[model samples]
Target: DAGITQSPRHKVTETGTPVTLRCHQTENHRYMYWYRQDPGHGLRLIHYSYGVKDTDKGEVSDGYSVSRSKTEDFLLTLESATSSQTSVYFCAIRQGIGQPQHFGDGTRLSIL
Candidate 1:
């Protein structure tokens, strides 16, 4: 949605390091999501939150963690950066199931 924003649109980190990315929304949507996109593989969900403090792992949950302490914010953390984790990460929000989800501009992460 127009109210959703992802911070530090770009980042570079070394392998084995920890990195955290933030997503902030003003729309007050109950559903928020984190996804990663890589060439050829398309988009993959990393994690999602149904509401404040309620989050679940997705298809690529390994090495990644997420937290949502308030309705307007969600955080994605990479426990240990890896070269394979380098990709464009995106944050999305929707009012409810079946509703169109709007996405924020992706964060491009590079692990050296």
Candidate 2:
């Protein structure tokens, strides 16, 4: 198993507020990613990290930010929450290039 854990299984916040979601892994994976799942777009990557303090933006990275300061932890932050940003967020970890990724249960976020 990947041994991944996502915090705050559910969240509801007002628009314009800042929110953060965290992902923790017990396995020492080298790569970690944050993705948001929506009805029409499927799964879209928000940000990813190759190593500690080495992070890059993904396809839908405009309103989101990510940080990875340790091997086991990846954090996703919304600069200012919006209704359009309301979706299920998932965190995945992979050992390397061709390895399978393991995902957490995901956090359900609702913005009103």
Candidate 3:
């Protein structure tokens, strides 16, 4: 197993609604991340955690938030979603930062 899954591979939301996406990993990895992929930006990091409760925001963290309290699960929440937030969200993990990351398929999020 690749040790990961994202919930609701497809979604449609209004311009300003609260939405949450789930990322599940089976293998115990040391790092997990949330990233959004768009036509122009390619992939941009939203947030990540090195361990339980040891997370920090990333470059595109505005209006978005994340939490990881367990080794196998990471959650991303859009507090007040907007149309501009429509994009494919991917979850990733790495045994260590120096190495490449393994990514989940992706959660297709559409904020109206």
The estimated TM-scores of all candidates read 0.97, 0.97, 0.95
Give candidate 1 regions above 4 Å deviation. none
Candidate 2 C-alpha error for residue 88, in Å? 0.2
What is the per-residue lDDT of model 1 for residues 63-97, given as tens digits with 9 covering 90 to 100? 99999999999999998899999999999999998
**Residue clash pairs of candidate 1:** none
**Candidate 1 residue 56 C-alpha distance from true site, Å:** 0.5
> Measured by TM-score, how close is model 1 to the native structure?
0.97
lDDT of 3 by residue, 7-112 (tens): 9899999987999999999878889999999997899999999999889999899999898989999999999999989999999998876988999999999876
* lDDT value, candidate 2, whole model: 0.95
What lDDT does the true structure give each of the candidates? 0.95, 0.95, 0.92
Weakest lDDT window of 10 consecutive positions for candidate 3? 92-101
Error (Å) of candidate 3 at residue 35 is: 0.5
Question: What TM-score does candidate 2 get on C-alpha atoms?
Answer: 0.97
Specify the poorest-scoring 10-residue window by lDDT in model 1: 1-10
Task: Give per-residue CA lDDT, model 2, range 1-112, as digits (tens).
Answer: 5799999899999999999999999999999999999999899999999999999999999989888889999999998999999999999999999998889999999999
lDDT of 1 at 100: 90
